[model samples]
Target: MLPPASQFRAQQKRLDQFEALTGIKTTYSYVPYGQLLDKITTEAVGGSSEYDLFSFQDSWMASLVGYLNPLDASIAADKLDMGRYPEVFREACIVGGKTYGLPIRAHPQLLFYRKDLLGEVGAKVPASWSDMVATAGAIQNKSGISGVALDYVKGSGFQNLWLWFNCLWGHGSDLFDAAGQPRFNDAAGVAGTQAYVDVLLKDKVANPGSSQFNEYDMVNSMAQGKSAMIMVWWWTYSVLTGDRSRLKPEQVGFAPMVRFNGGKSPTLATLMPFGISKQSRHKAAAWEYLKWVSNPDLEVEIVCDKSDPQTSDIVATQTATYLNDKVNAVNHGLHRVALESLKGARILPKLTIWPEVASVLETTISEIVAVGKPVKPSLDDAAAQVARIARRSGRHRS
Candidate 1:
């Protein structure tokens, strides 16, 4: 689990409970996000892992598919209700018509802003990307703060590209066509890319340092009152309202991510699934652990636990966790807002070669943002590179 500090402690408590209830000893390891994919893949593919169960990002599904045990039989035998999970989250755990894992943590993007700043300027929450630019500008003019802080830092895998994808989707374009050919070099793609860049370069609304900012940096900027707004994962809500934060809870406001002027808003879902290793010698034991960890009741308890009583864990599975009144009352209705945002949420392309493809696109975006390269030529070159990768991987028939 790439847990926040509070969540890390909360998860530890749950693991202790799981061990006491089942008499199965459990140990936890914290792996940094940048190194997790390589570590999990290397150990699983080698068929001699130290761990029986592992959690992996949804985007790594296609690459790790070969080394994971299919959970269909286990789910059927246990009578687990897969229907309880959001379709977007449940679908992320499936590959080639088989269920490979269960989603334990799901995150959706949200536009978080300082309501006090917006109110002072008489600026409404932004409904479109253009509106966001205007609102941000208004807030900056009134407050003399950066209008937004975004995760634009390069080399952190796909965080930068995910923002670009939001813009791409909002413009009625995508990374690839149904035939799996690269399509992000088209006019819509160029427009989306330009809009994303202009937020920092031309509009001068986002923090200048945002060019090197990741999620944490953006969250810190908002929490410390350096920036007025940010579009980030839902989990950061805990940090913004937690005891360590510098701002009061009432200062922050949340909304779904911005869309194009006439387009429906679309947000990206980042899911983490728990899977049992195919090579595990203790398959049955591992299955039991997976079942316990994903049980809906347990999920609710973990998220709504009153130990802290202020911050809440964002559970990905189980509809009740998001809609239950008790849960929302404690967490300031974060779950309800997240559930609404999930209506427009989607996962990235499920391909084993996506990491490589994403790297190409990430570089293009960085070049455009950092060096002021023209969007068209950069996207064109990136499209060519991604098409080559797709062809090599047999994902692009054309």
Candidate 2:
């Protein structure tokens, strides 16, 4: 489990009820985000694990699947239909031909903008990247604030790659081809990368400090009224409208992520799923716990709960829950907006060495966006490095 222990704590509160209903006693342990991957992999390699179930990012499936119990039999036995989730979520939990886990948490990108600011400038919500730039520029000219705040800074998690990939996919380009060769240096790829960078340099509508901003910084920029718009994960709506923020709930508006004109619009999605350990002594009990925690009813309850601020979360993994009328009423229809975005969402490449590939992209984006490095040549260098990495790891097309 990652930080923001509040969500886990809330789930912990329901353990007694679960025990009463199913005679299954469960407990959860918290792990820091940075240390979790190593901890899970190390324990697995030692031929034992400290936990019966492992909660992890979807991208880690390639590395951890061998040590995980496939849930296909259990899923069929329990009559659990995986189709209830969106396509991206369903695919994220399956590797090769086996289902590994159930999605517990997921995030789709949304463009969060200031409603009052846009109204004042007579700008409608942007449906494309060009519209966003023009709208952002109009708001900036009128308000004297940066049009948008972006995360161009390098981070341990490679935050910059998250946004850049959306542009890449939007422009009909991808990080690799069907046979797993580097193609991000091709014409469409260079154009996509250039469009993303132009938000900060060419358009000049981006926050001046965006070169150093992380995801949290972009959210803070919205809370403080320093910027007019931010393209971020849907979960941030809770923080942006919470007690600490200066803006009112009515002031913030959200829409699906913008796309390149007439191109594919694929928003990046992050999914967290819990898998049963292959070495666990309590696979049945762990499956019970997984089902209970991921139940759509419980998800709707948590999203609608206003009693505890600590436990309040708007992220929903099930399509039914996102479209539920009750959930939409309380959440300002945020889940509905998220559902629209998830229609064309995409998960990261499920390669075991994605972390390394992300590192290459992070450096390339920083060099081009912050240091004014030439885009095409920098991307060419990155493609070459990635090709070498793939060849050495036996992941290349040849």
Candidate 3:
């Protein structure tokens, strides 16, 4: 599991407790995500015992799904019991006609706003793209507060590309064609890009520094009431609930994205996937490890981690974590309701290439928006580069 340091320690404590209870001995170590994935890949491909169980960001599921063995029978035959799990998360394991992972954290994106500020402005929370734009402008024009914080810092322009792409996909546009080809230059994509860009450029509804502000900035901005609203993932609820001691918890609120500019869009559910290596002689132990790590008790610890790690594991099926009292107290109006909204969320491409392709597209977003270049040509260039990446990786683009 690739959580921050505090999370690793607390989870380690729980895992240690689990081993004693189950009488199944095991050991674990922590490393950076890139280092861990690289080591595991080398071992799995080389057919060596490089690792056993793994937890990773959702994007890699499509690529690794083909390489790992199915666990449906493992659970069905009593090696583990699937019935005890939340169905939503359990299904995320089944990708490309195979069961490859479990949900360690269910990552869902949401729109966070200042309920008090909206009331002071006599404005209602936006429920559509048109409404969101208008809301942003209204807040900025009237309150001198940016309507929405740009959550794009740390290559946020890069992160925005993927989140924006999800909105595009939900709006009936595809960044790429079915054969793993890039179509970001297509009319729908161009239109989507224009609409997304308009929020920052034409509409002035978002923070001007959004291009430079990463999630940390968004956290500080929103937590301190700098921005009236922000779109962010589920786990942010932790830091968002606290402020610089001056701001009380009552300042924040959460809500599902009202709608894309087109009226409605798909809800995207991002998950951290759990997997067992094909190279493990302890396949049974690894499977048991997944079951143990993901048990409701342990999963809740991951979600509502009271630890300093802030590693809330938002498992695939557990929206209950969305209803924490502390989170609700910070922003009562939207937290739980927004959590329930996750049930209808959609998963993006599970292919391994998405990580690289997404990175390419994100890097291009700032370039396109900065130079006043049109999205179509920029996307075209992005697509070609992504295709070349796929070819070089020794796999065809999906």
Q: Ten consecutive residues with minimal summed lDDT in candidate 3?
A: 309-318
lDDT of 2 by residue, 1-398 (tens): 44444556678877898999899878777888778899888878998856899888899999899999999999999999788999999999999989998998888999999999999999999988899999999999999989999998886488888889888888889999988889999999999999999989999999998888888998899888899999989888887888889999999999987777553588899998889999899988888988898888888888888788777778779999989999999998898889888877899888887888888989889888889999999999999999989998889986
- Summarize candidate 1's per-residue lDDT along 215-279 as a digit string, tens digits: 78889998888999988788888778778788899998998767664646577888888888888
Candidate number achieving the greatest lDDT relative to the actual structure = 2
Error of 2 at 100 (Å): 0.6
List runs of model 2 lying over 4 Å from the truth: 1-5
| lDDT of residue 342 for candidate 1 | 81
Ranking by lDDT: 2, 1, 3
Q: Which whole-number lDDT from 0 to 100 does residue 147 have in model 1?
A: 93
* Candidate 1 clash pair list: none
lDDT of 3 at 266: 66
TM-score of decoy 2: 0.97
Reference-based lDDT, residue 179, model 1: 84
RMSD of each: 2.2, 1.2, 3.7
